[model samples]
Target: MLLRFTTLSALFFAYTLAWAQQSNSLFFMHRIPQSNLINPAVQIDCPVYVGVPFLSSLHLNLNSTGYSYNDIANGTGTINFPALVGQMHSWDYLSEELHYTPVSFGFMYDNDQYFNFAWTERVESKLFVSKRLMSLFANGNTQYVGNGLVTSNPGLNSFYYREFSFGYSTRLRGDVLVGAHAKILFGLAGLYTKRNSVDIEIDALTHNINARWNPQVNVAYPIGVTTDAAGNVTGVSAGAFSPLPFSLNFSNPGLAFDLGFVKPNDPITWSGSILDLGFIWWLKSTSRFTNDGHFVYRGATPADLTNPDAYIDMLADSINNQVQFQHSNGSFVSFLNPKAYFGGTYAFTPQLLAGAHVRTEWYPGRPVVGLTLSAIAMAKKGSSVSLTYSVMNGSFANIGAAFNIGGESFQFYILADNLLAPFYPERVRNANLRFGFNLFWGCKQKKKKLSIPESSGGGCFWTWGLDQKRKQHGVK
Candidate 1:
């Protein structure tokens, strides 16, 4: 009863925030999402006050753990759910969130590939207008929604998920900037299977079943037909020759926010290095709502099997009432969105920069701290290279090199991460390689700074229209 009630409540909350809560952690460059300790505006590679850049990035992440599931068969933890193995069960999310204008659009995909020949896929897309739009609705606020799951073959392969987010920033004064993001969520699950079973009527209190049926257990049984005592018809199962695994799909979106600040160098005062700081606030996270029902196939009498619809109604009714979910199952953890870090970049020399950053993520209480060192060679042209080392439960590192032609006309880059993983997975390692090229089709020179004149204000002659007034004053 407790489990059922909690599941229902999760479903309710998920519905309330379904489109707002999502996770996109697959990309390594998601510094803003992974570590919210710095103002994203300041991190823009292009000149500020300019247009947003066109950007595309791809990232692949892999996670695995070893454990035993006694409930399945002895303590073996064999693949009872074949489709839930390998890629399907791997917890990784993908997103495209860097776009132009005050609005942004992002798509996220997550899947768990645990068992071979079985798989799950989830896709999510988000559209964000300025949070200022909140005033347009009542309470001066409105919720955002995103889609995160799709089931193609149904029972053979299923996907599940949750996501939500929002961000904002404004100028406190010249050189001081602040911003934040908020998110909300909900989720659901779908299941499809080639095989099924039937349970016969028994005393509700005693829990003694009078009969039982197993649709398929071995290659001989397959999934097309079932028999009774007289070898009579019981169930019709198709798709046996094609052999598809049972599948389920779920989606949830939630709400969270991030606040940040940027303090750039001040040439007139202290020539100090640029400083970046950020804070993220995540709340109201919910999980997926797997339908709570036992299904039935052909030839099962009403008394022979419990009504699947009744179970669904009961769960829905529980949702109508408020409740909280439990995480007793494997891989389930205490839920809360964690705050993270995002500040870095300190210049040690005219051509050299070094910085450090730290961030904490939810679900596993994992903390990552990293340092980056980069240098540009002094030459007629320009060349630069950078190396980053991150330490967490495991150590991760990356190396990147950039070459420039004619100072700004042409550029080439090569980047790699987790190079050490190939040498050691258990000893601590991870890696990837990336390359990029950029060129300008047209050349335009920067305009020279103009000098303004200062008049009777006793300021420099190049202030406002002061140059003309200075001539008049000299004549007088």
Candidate 2:
């Protein structure tokens, strides 16, 4: 069981390290309609906008708090296990986030209010593990003969869901613009652990092992499990069961909300938001598995030290014989990872601005935070270019750039948090990218000021002055 779980985690970590999350680059691009995903208070210049189906927005992010690829692998395509283990913290996390919007549209109403709708699909995954637990698996228990090993709160939380959102933004007193998104969520699949604990001790003289395991896991996926007569799970088959596709899963429902505000004051603008405050009660095709077992193994002898394979096989068999899992159908609840943003911008000119942004995401174990500073240049035709420097996920080499190019009828934009990650993948810990296309209409520009008439050539001003003087003197 330990080997299988470790292998699966390692594979997932490796796969997600190459892909990438909420992008800091997009947070400050107010001209892009999709920027509302980060801060709903952001209002696009166009009076009406529609997102291209399936191509409006795509977001992907991958991050690790423990070690990067370079710390584990050498230049010669060899993995250095000891080096990787040495760089790990007491507790580490690996996370993946994805968002794709299929349909979205917005229109201005009452001249001061905006209303929008969107259908989005999202996936989130996070894995937390203990360093000592990893060391116990990698280096063996010989070093811990008397003390043994104890690990707590090591587990995985992953889920897939769809969101149908209705949003509104309106101007308030003091020229403050406030907005919110009310979302209805449908869960498709999930895997979560409520409790996970492991304790093991070996006698100093006899090397006898005493172990206790208490783990409870909940699953809501489409699969069939095979169990032995003793109620121990032995195998799993995916082809044995069929379920509705993710797009059609409405049995598991939830709700969420996002609130934000933007305050503009001449050259300075302030903005903040709180997003994804919600939970899903999973009641469809859910199963709960729990195992609480304590056992002793007195089969180890001094002679078995020379043959490590035989000793490992003996230990595995003892565990299998002692531990049995209890399974039942039950409902579970999982919460969405919430995030917050606080930021401000300074406009040096009508066409140029500088901004600083702070973002935080609350996960299970710890909160992840990032800071970004950016400069944006806007064109009169509603196009923009931005460059940014960000410090995120323990990586300092993040240099980002974005561009929005289009005319009155259509727009296309691409935003990324770490443009260098693809080229220098070994040096960075995380990467994110968002891109989309949209159709726009009734784009309004800054109204131009009317020029004053010259006094020397003013034919109407002289007559107006003479008429005012005659009226003051009572001579009509």
TM-score of each predicted structure versus truth: 0.36, 0.86
In model 1, the Cα lDDT at residue 351 comes to 39
Clashes of 1: 70
Candidate 2 structure lDDT: 0.75
Candidate 1 global TM-score: 0.36
Clashing residue pairs in all predictions, respectively, total: 70, 5
lDDT of 2 by residue, 1-476 (tens): 55457655655554345434547888777778887887887666666789988898988887887667776775545655566567677776788888899899887674467788889998988897767767765666687897788877478999999999899988776657889999999998899987467888978887776878787889887667788887778766553344545558799999999999887665567889999999999998888888877878785567999898989988788777777777778999998889999998787665677999998988775687888998988775668889999887666778998898983579999988788888978756767888889998654333443122222111111112222322322334
Superposed Cα deviation of residue 199, candidate 1 (Å): 30
Off by over 4 Å in 2: 7-18, 138-150, 199-211, 239-246, 295-302, 444-476
Error of 1 at 439 (Å): 9.4
lDDT of 1 by residue, 46-100 (tens): 1111111222112233321111122112334332322112212112111112111
Q: What is each predicted model's overall lDDT from 0 to 1?
A: 0.27, 0.75
Global lDDT for candidate 1? 0.27
Cα deviation in Å at residue 119, candidate 1? 24
Error of 1 at 170 (Å): 4.2
